[model samples]
Target: MDKVGETVLEIDLEALAHNYNYLKSKLLPKTKFLAVVKAFAYGSDMVAIAKKMESLGVDYFAVAYVREGVLLREAGIVTPILVLHPQPVNFEQLITYQLEPSLYSPKILVEFLKTAREKKLKNYPVHIKFNTGLNRLGFWETDVDYISKQLDNRDEIKITAILSHLAASEDPDEKEFSDTQIKIFKKISVALNERLGYSPFRHMLNTSGIINYPEAQFEMVRSGIGLYGYGNSAIEDKNLKPVAQLKTIISQIHKIEPGETVGYNRAFSSEGYRTTATLPLGHADGIGRQYGNGKGYVHIKGKKAPIIGNVCMDMIMVDVTEIDCVEGDEVLVFGQDNSADAFASSAQTISYEILTAISQRIKRIIR
Candidate 1:
């Protein structure tokens, strides 16, 4: 794509497809692929990503909430959607949209069953989430009996899948913990299957799990960041391409004399003759305050222009003294060349946070 004239996020559908195919290649033929498109597809366009993945024949799509699922359904997405953290208040809407819920607690399970029965539904699909080690949102291993008793004779809902989250599949030091989580998940799955008189499809692998622990890939695997680019490791990242490239044009140029302040609170006082460029995106645009005061930098004309002031609500000033750049020159905030991972690392954060933090107001140019 050419230089972006304004602050925009370029979504490369081809890159997305490449990442999807690469990750899919690691799975067994029968292992279902569930693309986690939650958080607006990690701050990219969710509907667009889902449409692409669906066209790629993904078996399932997971979203964080019922409304996200509703959006996909409204967009004519026919694939099965699993809501990872559904609320009881929206259980009716979830059922209306034919979105499955991950029932992690007894209260949620009972509430959803009540709603399912109220709708006069039969065998409505729902996933049971077990807290193997994540300890976030899921039932304990001992909850298997409770879940089975709750659904013993009820035809309102059916446990179609059992799921769990890995706390640190990306960290090599957490291998033992991840293994324990997987073991616990297997034990829980066995107990639940025996109690339910049938085996629900099991899945407990995220993007990194698919890369590091393919042996534990039970029946299905879910990936979010992997689809968007960063593979949680330098090695795996080379195999996948980033789908979003954030770019903007320099709004203005400034010649700062020595000791002159650059932005709010006099955060950056020029030490020497400096040339700076103002960008039209800041905290409001997802470039947070933490990236300000020379911590983060933007790539301009193949050179690094370090941000030199407190990131404002709608703008940021970068020291462009060494670059041969003028006003309106396209700047690379993060992209295939600079990489969101490297940019985020400057602020001591991860690529996932930076990518998802991108504001929805930015124009998304789909390539």
Candidate 2:
């Protein structure tokens, strides 16, 4: 924690490597891996995480926008990056940066093809996202024939892989639906390969897919939250190592007499004399007000301090009467000792939302 600010996210590169190795072990021998490093690598410093992944021999990277890919390229990342949802306007920049675009719909395909011709590109790598059941993005099942017709004798845009999204691969109750989605993806891949006269790589499994449907992990699989120490399962969740530890120091301590109030709107009134510690993190720092009023708890001296009153933009009050602590003492907001999953559950949210919602302003210290 040397040179760390008032509040910081300590990213353990060893834990990240452990999670990557753990997940990679679940795949077959020849299965390639694509790490989703979008949204600043789930709010854990994208450039740092990407560099680590590159060092670990990751096959590909996925980002939501072309600008993210461009930034990675500018940072000297030579690994192939897939822009999952690139707009037509960014097609030229994608080609210029050598970023592969996932052309899902007809419009994207046509516009990208036009851009390729205009840029005098040939055999540019691209991925086709087919809508198996998620229906969020990608070509529908009916668009298979249309896609083949559009790509007839077109060598400028070469299809490198076919991929799809899994709606609920981790839920046991939705296992049947996930299987159906896999079936649809397989059917589409077969039709596509027959029409194109050559089979390209096919991948449909994401993080949960790798854990739940390893048998269907075609040629490659993508890992996202799992690499950040979440598996959406009780068993695997216990095995993965949490990468980020969110911590802050107690800024000040207040001795409140009975009936005294704290924070805005007098949301908390001390029934009895209480000792409280004010932290430097607040809603602006991604600790939402929903976690206030005793919903979320922080760790101090191995004891839990429930939050009091409404969380402010720059401060939060926690009842520390039971814990032995002092001003400037380190407090665990969420991490190895205080699980983000448990903290998020108190706020009625998932760990993903809590982790990604951490503000980018907070410095990330990699260990």
Candidate 3:
């Protein structure tokens, strides 16, 4: 708890470990845990988060791209890395870095196979991604036979795992859709395994799925938000702890007269003489404009300082007329006192958007 500085993302490794163990406790005895460290570990420090997870004996690590996996490798992480949405163009880099790529299409499978062969690869590990319900990425269920056939012809590539993304695993109320997804995923697994004459590890659970559908836990579970301390489900959300807290310092204080405006667009007009504190954070740092114009607030000391006016690229103003604040007071953008969930509510968004939307350039202080 050092003095809060400008635009710093404080990561509590202890809290992260606590969250990891808590989620691990919920898993079945045979299920393995895979930490998703993609998007710079969800806009926190990836290298530090991955190292911490590795120390805790996480089964594997997943990233969104080949470069992300390469970053972990370059940092000396020996743990197996899964590239979730790898492209055909990066197959050579993936192979060269010994990173596993998630093959989601026939073209991707065929291209990666060629690259693997050219690199003299034998049983080169690759995960097959089936689009169960997300509809965002991965191959369709109808493409399962084609995928199996392609793998059958390509001996250079080893089918490491068959995985799918849950469309709504966090919302237990949406049990029907989640159950349907699980059923489809299981069917795909069975069909692929039968066709290939062997079974690869099957994983379909994200943070939400792991909590709501314990019965759906396959050989491995990929957790992205949960690892970062959010289950996004009512039941699971209660137990998990947040891993990041966006903290910044109050740079200046302004006392505006009645009718005066603040920030860009004159979005916030002072109703009366009021005090405002400008913090060293803005949309560029991931606090989007959606939080502007009294829509959001930052925690000053222990009180809520409502946001005022438009969010600039490098700064934002908060109405601190009532708070006993100063120029150098610590501002809690989103943390234990003012949870990301609370801040997101102000903008009619979710914790995921608030967390992942954070910019990468901000300084990360790991505790």
Candidate number with greatest lDDT: 1
Query: Over 4 Å off in model 2, which ranges?
Result: 1-5
Pairs in steric clash, model 1: none
Residue-pair clashes per prediction, in order, are 0, 0, 0
lDDT of 1 by residue, 11-75 (tens): 99999999999998999999999999999999999999999999999999999999999999999
Better of 2 and 3 by lDDT: 2
- Model 2 Cα lDDT, one tens digit per residue, 263-362: 9999999999999999999999899999999999998878899999999998999999988889999888888877778899999999988898999888
Error of 3 at 272 (Å): 1.1
**Model 1 misses residue 107 by how many Å?**
0.6
Candidates 1 and 2: which is better by lDDT?
1
Winner by TM-score:
1
TM-score of each: 0.99, 0.98, 0.97
How much is the lDDT of residue 200 in candidate 2? 86
- Compared with the true structure, all predictions reach lDDT values of 0.93, 0.91, 0.87
Compute the lDDT of residue 53 as modeled in candidate 2: 95
